[model samples]
Target: MLLASAMTFSAGAVTPGGEAETIYYNARVMTVNDHFDITDAVAIKAGRIMAVGSHAQLQELAGNDTRQVDLQGKSLLPGFYDGHIHVGTGPRPFGATFNVPTPDQLTEILAREAAKVPAGDWLVGLMNRPHCHMQMPNRWELDAIVPDHPVMLACGVLKLTLNSKAIELAGLSKDTPEPKDGLIVRDEQGEPQGVLTMGARRYATRVIPNPALSDDSARDNLRAQLAKFLPMGVTSVNIAGVRPNELRLIQDVYQRWGDELPRATLQIFLFPGYDDVDTSLAELEGLGFRTGIGNDRLKLGAIKMSMDGAIAVPDFRTLKPYDGKVRFDERGPWENQKGDFNGVTVIPKDSLYRVASRAHELGWQLGIHTIGDGAVVEAVEVLERVLREYPREDHRHHLHHLTIRPPEETLAKIAELDLIVDTQPNYTYYNNAFMLAAVSGNRLERQNPQRSLLERGIRIAYGSDGLPHGPLLGIWAAVNRLGHDGKVYGAEEAISVEEAIRAYTRGPAYLTFDEQERGSIEVGKVADLVVLAEDPLSVDPLRLRDLAVERTIIAGQELFHGSHVEPYHQRPPTP
Candidate 1:
């Protein structure tokens, strides 16, 4: 706690002689502010920005102690923020990095890994979808390859598949009761086909080897993940899905790497009523702090709760069924819906309100994952109850997903309630990847609805829901809305590149409740910014993904130089 207090003081105080700690010049600086201002240089002192102006103006403020650098016309902008993403804090073998499109390919890979490892050892693989033959892989297909070793391969945000061995190891059987919060896709014979949706992964999670996830593991994992983010110009992230069991190790890692890595804001995940909510709240209460307690490098964020599910599964709890043909209806799992609906609500409405209301009462900002319009309305309704009781206008409780294309009433309530919509623009790019075929005619108009939300004065923030975790990809998605098949899904929803950039930078800073200290190249803000190889505004929207981060600077230090990583800024001279 003393160290945290020291960091707090050191981050904001300027040094003697008002000398800058670092000075970056000769770059096009995008000050993502109310005016969308541009500048030529910035001066940082004690890990915070001291001034922003023309190169000459900043030079006048810099002293000999300043580490001056010329960007050579590169574009400098604030760090990209991922409003929602899950980092694996458990023991996971770095199995496959590449995508496997066919089920046979997956079988071949898993079979080889199975052979190398011990028979009883769980072969946990990461980074690939449940490779399939025109559909998700089944337990039998996986069993044919490796019936001896238990194999669990997970694709982040999607579903996970298990071989027969894994199915048994997780205690899943024909008699196994399905989780109230998730679906266990089963065959006609009433047997699980091996796909575990959303919260249902608890079956596999219980069996997956955790190794107790020591603090060292958290440091190593956070270090490896930060390496990946820094290169892509991501200097801040919302550790959006920190499960109940993983919280301790993650917090310990944060205490250690808070100043050493890219800044992070943690949003603890609230399991679907099965996990003791009070126990989780007590842990936070015992932390000697609440949200926004730590220094600039780290802070506690919102409470994350899932309401609806994914768009691919069409489980977003829509008001109507997907207006399509055999696409969504062709299912193996629960199709307990009427009309054109292929959706299901994950959390009980009453429980959602209870958890959110309790969290609000406990002084935590809320970020509920609500994909469907129905979920969005319900979320706002719950927030209204909290706001009416608490009377905190700036709580800034946000709605995640809303990918189901909210209706006018939902959008109006979002604006009226002063709610932030944490969107994954990258998911919009997948418009052509899924749902378009099965989607009803008019439903496509509401997907994302960025322009509409902005018009209604709603704050829109961008996040990469780990779909490759590329901010440029997300910006491209927002600006173009072009699907993989080369057609724009929602032309009216498309926004300008500047607006998209703001959503990534300024917008997220607000959600993290640190807009005053970040989100722009402004005076007195933390110098957590990225230097791009080219101007994103001038580049072709389609070519945005080609843009590279030349350097990533956090807290007055260049933590990322070109393709290389740098050490921490050494506590900013103790102010």
Candidate 2:
């Protein structure tokens, strides 16, 4: 447990512990502790929660100099812990430039974006199709838009569509041999169609010059991303897939703006193709980093690995074939097709097992990205094998995005192995429609398997994956299971609002091994919390996403307040 008890202070008295700071009171606080206790107030000192009880009780402990704010009956809960997020690349570059719809809309957006850029400069865009409530653009469509400029657009996973210019620039023609873990799409004429799937995208992307951004520019972009999260009441995030350079930049900014920024948990997964298993682990260890290092402001968490691709793109290694429709003699989409389906492991399974086993031996945790059933099974097998061979207790290996598992049996194995499932319920709501259309069809009932996993005693955690990383949005999706066409996909699999909240907070914390300090709002833990406009449990399921955030506080300092409240940051005593 990474939690500490609140320091005791006399009622109506202030203790000058040098670093002790401000406190808050007079709020409807729901501390999702062992008892699921709800209280009227909370007190803070030295960036740790002091007391959690009635308003009268907490106020009695306030010191004469302690700056106090009345919550005025607003609702407050622990700040959200996002188990999965791609943070190293920062926010998507096309965030402001595109309102990506489906394939047609994406084509339109690309054409418009291409028109704006100069002729020769590479035209790059990221489209979130799995969750983007739209159609996916293909390589042919991209070619039609910018025939001159080399264009590369990546959909949610590493799946990419490239134009003729991009293919030519990367020196990939019909005869270009596919890389070990990648695929090159070709037309019926046996010519390259410019659709680079999975690992192949890396080749083209590497050749394209990265857009230049100064430190100030990077900070500005980061601030914009932070602003987006603040309103949604997200105070902390586990940034997935970050390189050392980006990590350094984030660390520099965080140290300088420690007082103002949101509490962040930085999980720097080595880039997929850049670093080998030993090299990556060595780099992480060389930084003098541990699984959970840093104070309330920022911390380094687990190492991440992508064990497979996504199912929506049909590259995920699935037991059944996705033939665009049900057929008697169907071939698994990626196997016989132009695409590859060895399932693009970030590192070889044996290498990943070795590295994860080493990490476990060193008291670190591992987070492996597994999307399809095969991928999930492979990941679980690896973890199980490593645990049995190395015998580390409380390893807490996490399987990210277990999108399409068969049933509770696999989850039961997970529970038995004590592995954690870091899932994204928001994907269900956002991708339900596309998933129904492209991959599973009526089998969508088997998708996600949240209810089944919970029932089987599997430890399940929730994350947004940032396509739509709003906790409220995720809560709504879990509760309602609403599809794109306004129909509910699997109501039976729908979880309760309370369960959903737990998955986002307590569950994720446990997965990250930070349950003791941050997940629940108990006395003696770090004072990282969110003040919502309304009680989530009390709101209608459909209205969950509509519920607004009134304030966000981390380490006893307010980071975001309602539009009506004043902005401020408090520091400990200087003496």
Q: Judged by lDDT, which candidate is best?
A: 1
Which ranges in model 1 have alpha carbons more than 4 Å from their true place? 1-16, 62-65, 91-104, 118-122, 127-135, 168-175, 208-212, 244-248, 272-289, 312-314, 324-341, 430-434, 563-575
Which number leads on TM-score?
1
Q: What is the lDDT of candidate 2?
A: 0.68
Which ten residues in a row are the worst by lDDT in model 1?
Answer: 566-575
Tens-digit lDDT string for candidate 2 (1-575): 11223346333334434323565567778888876778777778766677777656555566678787787777889988777765533456422234454443665777787788888878777655543322334456667777778877766655666677887788887777766455666666656766565677766777876666678767766656655666667767777656666776777768777667666777657533334666766765676656777776677777777776665444565555543332211122343454333344445567667677777777777788887777787778888887888887777778888887654466777989988888888777666544553454545665776887888888898888874667887888888887644667778889998899888888878876777778888766778898877778887788887777788887777777774221111111110
> Alpha carbon lDDT of residue 234, candidate 1?
81
Q: TM-score, each model?
A: 0.87, 0.84
User: Cα-based RMSD of the predictions, in order?
Assistant: 7.5, 7.4
Candidate 2 Cα misplacement greater than 4 A, ranges = 1-26, 62-72, 89-118, 128-134, 271-289, 323-348, 406-408, 441-443, 563-575
Which digits, one per residue and each the tens of the lDDT, describe model 1 over residues 57-134? 666666777788899998999877766666775334333333454444776777677777787877776534212211
